[model samples]
Target: MSAWLFDLGNTRLKCAPLREDGAPGEAVALPHRREDAAAALAQVLPARFEVAYLASVADPALRLAVLEALGARCRRIAIARTQARFGALRVAYAQPRRLGVDRFLALLAAHARGGAALVCGVGTALTVDLLDGDGLHRGGRIAPSPATMREALHARAPQLPDTGGAYREFAADTDDALASGCEGAALALIERSRAAATELLGRAPPLLLHGGGAAALAAHLPDAIEIPGLVLDGLARWAAVERAAGG
Candidate 1:
């Protein structure tokens, strides 16, 4: 039986299927809306799946809509904050129930890959999660995304113009100025979090950069390891554990 994984994030929804052997198949992304999710699923999934897992960080209404759409076609499994032991990584959330399931799953997935890792997800917001070599989820941080900074500035201040240029290390003029500033701010925040994680872990954890804003910040993060589909990877791992537990 195949396993279907859904990552319901703030800005977008992503879905992918993992074959029985753990190989990822096709993946798709849609806007984070009930109508869009329903339409996308209708277009892509015609047959019933074996197991379905969801990691949502969006509105509860939209999340329910997704669950309703999936219906009785598959065994639906919503990821929750549970005591998960993957290697040596101990989930230490103050209130596991309050923690983002997607973040937790992503950290678990990175731990499954072995060794210390800094799992960074750059989407509507940027998140940096630290996992030690012993597989302990020490902690993480969240900050505004590069695009959000630029957009927010444009929205709040009438004087700031929207400059459609790639983020660079140095801005030649005003247009590039906004781009560089916003991008630099995001980079600095991420780097600071990385440094903190390094200090805690005693070595620079292998960085795993993922999400929409990853490409924009790629130039800024020279030494970090970049990996796409981290959420999908995490969902897949979570599905395996859920299956073993007969959920």
Candidate 2:
């Protein structure tokens, strides 16, 4: 039976299926709007799937809408949670119930890879959650993403032009200046959290980078291991757990 996983994030809804070998199948991204989600689901889900899992950070109303669209197409529909152990890692949230499903899933994936890790999700926002060598979550940080920084600058100072690109080591002009400013800020936030994680874990952990802006930031992160589908891998892992649990 095929497993379907949905990550309902703040900006977009990412959907993917787990192949028989438990790897992520092709992923589809759609706007967070209900209509868009319905349309995307209609196009992606095949007739043979037997199970569905949803990881949503959005409101319950929106989640219900997506479920409504799915409409008994699968035998089971499990909502992703911030619980369950995948190898060494345990979802370590002061309130695990309040933890974002995506963060929880990512930690599971990192633990499955086996080792200390700093899982960074860079999208509309930048979130870094850490898992120790023993797979114990040690908490993390959240900060403005590059686009959020740029948008804030533009919103506050109307004269700045909309811009984005790689930051030069030494910015020479206005464009580079803006890029460097935002890039430096983001890097500082990321590095500081990474440093703290290393100190806590007693060694520099491997950084697993994911999310929409990961590729853009990967070039600048010499300390991180860029993984394009880290979250999807986590989703697939969660699917496996749910199936085993008889859900």
Candidate 3:
């Protein structure tokens, strides 16, 4: 039976085929605008699948629209949720549901990599998670991403350009200063998290970067490993475990 994985976030929806090797195939991203989600999926998705596994962190109405579209093409749909434990990984959240499934899935993917990691997801929001080699989720932080920060500032100030400009240590212009400040803030947080993780774990964890905004920051962090398919990869793992248990 053929299956697919869907990751619906605040800004976009990414779908990919679940391969026989238990991995997610190349992902196709679609804008998750409220009115266009169904139309967008209809244009790109095939007519049928035996199962559709979804991990969503979007508005209810938007999720319903996508679910309606998937229902027409898929025989079964499985929605992923945050869990206190998944295999060896133990979530640090006292209330698992409070933790976004996207972050949980990213932690799952990072733990599968078999080492300590500082996982950063840079999208509508910036998220940083620490996972020990033993599959313990040490918690994380969330804040506005650089783009979101710029957009928020523009929304309030009106005169500040929402986009453009380059990052420099000492920017002389307003545009450059905005870019540097926002991007630097996010970068600084990631570095701080990494440093703290090192102190706690007695070793510096490898930084794993993911999400739409990751590439922009990747250029600045030479040691960071960018895995664009991380969440989908974790979904694949989740599917595998579910299947193994005959779910």
Candidate 4:
């Protein structure tokens, strides 16, 4: 039977099928607008699936729209949430929901892959969460993503056009400066967190990068392993566990 995995973010809604091995297949991305987000999901999704699992950090209204669309064709729809504990991963948050579902899922997926990992998600926001080899979440940090930073800069100074920029070590132009500065900020944070994780864990953990902005960040963090659709992987794992429990 076919099943679907959907990751709803601030700017995009990514949907994909689950392969037999429980990996996400080709992804279909649809832009989500603040003015009218529901239309995007209703327009892009059509096929019926045995089940649909989701992890969302979008507005509640937008989330509802996506779920409604999935409800139309999916026999079962499960919305993944941030739990205090799951499998080998234990959230550091005393109140799990305070932590984004996407972050929790990424940590779960990382733990499932085995070994200690520093999972960094660069998307609407840049989030870094550290998980020890023993499955204990070692806390995390969040900051405005490069894109968000750029947008903020533009908003604050309308003269700085948000569109043009290139990353460089020593930017000679305003565009390059903006690009490098924002990206560098994210990179610096990731590096600092990695260093902290290394000290706390007594060794350096593997760095796992994901989300829309991951590729750009990976270019700078050469050792970082880029993994797409990490949230979906965790959703699949959760679904499998739920199925086993029901049986």
lDDT of 3 by residue, 1-247 (tens): 7999999999989999999998998899998777877789987788887999999999899999999999999999999999999999999999999999999999999999998999999989999999999999999999999999999999999999999999999999999999999999999999999999999999999999999999989989999999998999899999898878776
* Candidate 1 residue spans exceeding 4 A from truth: 72-77, 80-87, 158-163
Weakest ten-residue segment in model 2 by summed lDDT: 84-93
For each candidate, the alpha-carbon lDDT, in order, equals 0.77, 0.80, 0.94, 0.86
Overall local distance difference test of candidate 1: 0.77
Show where candidate 3 strays beyond 4 Å: none
Q: What is the lDDT of residue 8 in candidate 3?
A: 96
- Output the lDDT of residue 167, model 2: 86
Quote the lDDT for 11 in model 4.
79
| Candidate 1 lDDT for residue 152 | 85
Q: For every model shown, what is its TM-score relative to the native structure?
A: 0.90, 0.89, 0.98, 0.94
> Which number leads on lDDT?
3
**Residues 152-180, model 1: lDDT tens digits:** 88899868875576666787877688888
Best by TM-score: 3
Model 2 lDDT tens row, 74-151: 777788777645556776666688778788888888888987888999877888998888878888888888877888
Which residue pairs does candidate 3 place in steric collision?
A: none
